[model samples]
Target: MRVLSIIVLLLTTGLTSCWPTSVSFNDTGSLHACLKHFQMDPLENSAPNAPINYPIELTEAIKSGIQNNTRLLLSGENTKPQVTITGKITNYVVSPIALQEGDNAAQNRLTVSATMDIYFDCPNDNYTHEMKVVSTRFADYNSSQDISSIESQLLSEINTQIVQDVINQILSNW
Candidate 1:
């Protein structure tokens, strides 16, 4: 019995040793190590059909998402940042989807697109890079519902998707 107990103890110790000592929960992947400061410029709304408030809402959402997912800090107005993101709403359109009997629409799809230009400055590595990413996402609502009644919810979903896309673009550089 003593031998068995010793074997079990050794096995437990061996297993524990193989386990990772530290786990990182950061979603920024390798970016947390290099880029520490970020700045977001006010987005321009070039989409003629988009609501006036869309640029503000999307800017805030992207900022919040980055802060929550990465270790990067927002640069102060007076400070130079290691990263800068600027973008414009390029497209916003609503169209019929899933046509039914007599060509009536069963659902309507709201699509939003944005063009982002991200600049990275890593003084430590003497590296500077710029990338342009265009992210487009959509949400659907029942044709019976008026778009005005559901626009906010649809925009919220699209914004989340756009945020993820932007993050992915940033992380993929490394």
Candidate 2:
């Protein structure tokens, strides 16, 4: 019995002592950390999903980005970059976390989760991988007027996160 117990402990210790393992194939954080560690850029300014497969929330986010920012190049019939970012919302929700009928604590939680699948069309063709990441945040308002404020800030932040995840995948795998 003592020998068996000792062997079990030894084996368990060995396994636990091993360095942290890689993140899931769908985890974007792992992908980003891996890329940032190497100080490499992972994007080619291409939209991976030409026929974008984002959820309604993501679509709204994209629209908002295009409207407010002049940096995103509009995709046309013959404008494709070397790499593209493809992502979809796996989860999106907004709920009131605390309500006091006033600005005291009436807060809403906004959360969005998405996974990115990056593919290289040129330079290194036939490279593809997927990453999943989630983001959540909170906002407070006393009336519906706050909707615009929250959407402008929280929604955009979440959208940025989703895009960054895709970018991370491209960078890390390269």
Candidate 3:
């Protein structure tokens, strides 16, 4: 009985004294802080049917969206790991969707397609991801309604969708 008690005590001591040295902490936690130091390059407009020569709509939207997204903190200029986002608007289309009584267009759809590459200057092995994002908007128009205003509104809607897509892509990479 004394030998049996000594064996039990020895077994418990041996089990408790061994600390696993194989476990290691993840270093990816710093990546989130690094994401705050972001920089956006001007988006290139390469669409053949693009009405404007510059991509102000697309560029401004993405910058604003990233700055406003809660998951990220925008750092104007910092020494941390830098995040660079570059992209181009590959497609832009405005087409009539609905016809009026006289065969005139009553409603139209606007679509914008873009591709973006996100690069992180961090130590992580996976630091870059290419994302293709698209947005579409529909508007009802007639002779009385202002065409420019409608177009602007449609563009705004498309920008909103694009921003959401960009945010989703970045979050999913994590």
Candidate 4:
């Protein structure tokens, strides 16, 4: 019995010592720590005759999204050259997606597209890349549901999707 107990204790110690191996992936924090600063510029409204004129709120949402993201740290006070992201809301269109009767629209889809320029300031060199992101949401013309409420929800979703895309683009390099 003493021999068995000793063997079990040795085996348990060996197993525990070999557990929890250090595993590191490409998304480690140390890898991203160098490019920590993320400066967001004012989002430009380039859409001529846009359906909605909520540029301030839209811009604020994008800024908040980038600041709140875990991958990148917001650099509002830094005056040095950092990662600057400039965006332009190019299109906001609501079109008929389906028809119920003759010339009657049953479903409508709202699509929002934005252009982003990601400028990276490295120690050796600086470069910029352009990425276009889009998001779409649909609404059904039902009498039971309020049209304005449906549109408001769709718009909110569109903004979120676009912001998520921007974050993905920023993180894709790492």
Candidate 5:
């Protein structure tokens, strides 16, 4: 009985001492911070297509995109901006290349393309400004990978980059 009790104590000690050795994310957390900084509350997930408008509509979009992401939901929260920027992801590009992978796998080169509309609404200024910024990035993923999963991941990663870039732009121009 004493040996059994000792074994139980040791087992419990080991179990309680265990923890996740690591936490990982590609860009979700940073993206979330950007969203929260912009003061977006995410709506339930559905088709990416949501109603859009000239300026304020873009605002909702920036909010929606950030809100939908798990990382952004945690980090990207701030009071709604007096002047905000928003845009839609109109075009996405996926092309093949002969780039070498770490394991020398024949895979396609990943690239992301999107058009962004930036909003500048300042009550102090007499003019409300809207501008478009186009952004792109190359995502390195195994070429010999599943199309759907790679595409989804590439888009998410680039979207996070885009959101970060756009937020930086807004901050600078302000």
Candidate 6:
């Protein structure tokens, strides 16, 4: 019994020693620590077929996402912000994606595309940097369902994806 106990203790110690002491699930650190304030401009809708309310919804989602994910505060035009974001919805389309027998539509996809420009104001350094990002995301639904009934849900999913993409781009600093 003493021999078995010694073996078990040795094995457990060896296994634990090989494991890391700490782990980080999120590698994307905070956006530049110097940036304390951010300004977001109203996004423009250039897509002819998109709903009138879509631009507003997406803008609000992006704004809230940034505020919730980062430590930066939202600033108005009266105050100069360290960062400014401007974008436009370039495309919105719904089309049949999967076809079944008899040329019937099995599924339809809703695609939304947008373009964004981020301006980093470095007043202390007397220089400014701009980054442009174009992101496209989609969601699919059964063809049997009416698009009007599920449009809001689909947009919500796509909004989350786009928001994540924007956040990743900002943090990547590339």
TM-score of each: 0.86, 0.40, 0.64, 0.70, 0.46, 0.82
lDDT of 3: 0.68
The lDDT values for all models are: 0.91, 0.46, 0.68, 0.66, 0.51, 0.89
The residue pairs that clash in candidate 4, if any, are: none
- Candidate number achieving the greatest lDDT relative to the actual structure: 1
Model 3 pairs whose backbones collide: none
lDDT of 4 by residue, 25-129 (tens): 545642244576777777777776444555666777777887787456677554554577777777776667666778677666666667777777666444444
Q: Give me the runs in candidate 3 sitting further than 4 Å from their true place.
A: 1-33, 75-81, 100-103, 124-146
lDDT by residue for model 1 (6-104), tens: 999999999999999888865546574668889999899999999999999999999998888777789997877999999999999999999999999
- Tell me the deviation in Å of residue 155 in model 4: 1.5
Q: What lDDT is reached at residue 82 by model 4?
A: 57
Model 2 scores a TM of 0.40
Model 5, residue 9: distance off in Å is: 62
- On residues 1-174, what C-alpha lDDT tens digit does candidate 2 reach at each position? 999999999999999899586656443532322121111122222323212333555655543443343223434456554334455545555656666755444566665555545333443344334343333333444445465455656655666765454444444554
Model 3, 162: alpha-carbon shift in Å?
Answer: 0.6
Q: Kindly provide the TM-score of model 1 when superposed on the true structure, using C-alpha atoms.
A: 0.86
Choose 3 or 4, whichever is better by lDDT.
3
Residue-level lDDT of model 3, residues 1-174, one tens digit each, is: 999999999999999789675775633432454455677788888888776843787788887897776345455544453577888888877777677887877766666778888776655544553444444333344544665667777677778878888877766664
Candidate 6: lDDT of 170?
78
Mark the 10 consecutive residues where model 6 has the least summed lDDT: 26-35
Alpha-carbon RMSD, candidate 3: 9.1
The candidate 2 region of ten consecutive residues with least summed lDDT is 34-43
Maximum-TM-score candidate: 1
The regions of model 4 sitting more than 4 angstroms off are: 1-19, 23-31, 51-53, 124-149
